[model samples]
Target: MIPSFPVDVERIDPLLASEVRRHYDRGGRTISFCSGSFLLATLGLLNQRTAITHWRYAEQFKQRFPHITYRDDSLYWYDGRIGCSAGSAAAIDLGIAVIRDDFGYEYANAVARRLVLPAHRDGGQSQFVQKPLAPVNAALAKVLDRAVKHSGSGSTVEQIAAKANMTRRTLDRHFIRHFNMTPHQWLCERKLEVARQLLETTHLSVEQIAGRAGFDNAVTLRHNFNKYLSVSPTKYRQTFKSSQQPF
Candidate 1:
């Protein structure tokens, strides 16, 4: 794992490159946080691979490493063995992602909670929040909190809207204004997050997890998992379940 560093165009060190190369040759994972991508690119590890750095450095890094595919909008990215994070806080997001892959969802969530952050942001989430047209309203905030708390209860959008004393149209308007998505879309994302957590942390069967996550059934769970994540729940569990317990 390489930490952030200043981007220096004339700072190549043969010794450092040789050491990083040796690790790569040993089949170890390579990860760069923020400006460390410059070193990774300099060592040829990022050649033809998708990468990112701080948005401030995106232009310079793209010019310097034009062969690498730079995604300026991603918070972080990992393709199995090699990974890159966009900026400072984004490094933590990448680290949690690594923990999710190496350990499991429960452990990753614990680590994130300790750091006082949401469980984990997907690598593909936007690198920064887009400026909202207006500040989030108190009712909208309450609705969000309520929806999350009741996410596993199979609550309908109408039920959630009523809890905030909102009509479905009002709720949809507020959701679109604040999140740029419908209320149902936001709810589905939360459900997916809940389903993934159960898959990685529990030995529950797919049907059980589906019910816990408020999906209609195992088929619904599988459909949503595949539609949103391009993977099935069973396959996701198989890939992410950890043998060791979380700290």
Candidate 2:
């Protein structure tokens, strides 16, 4: 069932919300798109559950429902019988996943082909979120652009700072203020994101993916994957693989 639009959670009828909660508690599956997660959350269905909403509203959702484990980076997320999608296009992705679960990969792929959408997408919000060049000074914007372009190149922080004609300290401050992360952290995240995409969509070996993702070797890639994602590269690939097809 679809929730009403303009998503004023406070206005949701208490009786209706209670009924929805009861339905889920009785083992009914629920799928929410974008701000519809608010309805499920208001019914207390999302407490301690991993879920996603439109990335633009992630912070607001978190503030309103602090108990939920909000996965801001996912296109969609599923925990047990509950599912959530980020924005409209991602709703289609979630639908395809449900189809695959009920039918099979072949049926889901057929539907995706008819819709002219990819059979599957890998990684997370990084693949869909457009990094806006905004609000920062021209120099900082240029530096950020360069960082995105060269994130998989194993570029040094000193080199990036030099490209911006800023001291390392100055670069660090700007990155912290603007990105809420250090340069090294941002670069590592970018590299790992790229590696995840490769793992899902390509037939590359772990060592090959590591080199392309700026890691020194497969060992380093595995170490960083475990540190950041709590899963080894091989395991991550296996978990997210779209079909039994090679790669």
TM-score of each: 0.80, 0.60
**lDDT (10s digit) by residue, model 2, range 1-247:** 4332344555778788777878888989888888888888877777877767887788888888888887754677764387788878888877877765554345667799889986553222212222232376788688778776876788778888898889999989888776666888878887886787688778899999999999889999998888766778898777665555521
Clashing pairs in 1: none
lDDT by residue for model 1 over 1-247, one digit each (tens)? 8897668664677888789999999999988998989888888898878888888888999888888888764777876688888877888877777777676678888899899986554422222322225777787687678778878888788887888888889888988887777888778878888888888778899999889999899999888888777778887788777777777
List per-candidate RMSD values in Å. Answer: 3.6, 6.5
In order, candidate lDDTs are 0.79, 0.73
The window of 10 residues in a row where model 2 has the poorest summed lDDT is 122-131
lDDT for model 2 comes to 0.73
**TM-score of the candidate numbered 1?**
0.80
Per-prediction backbone clash count: 0, 0
Q: Which stretches of model 1 miss by more than 4 angstroms?
A: 121-135, 158-182, 242-245
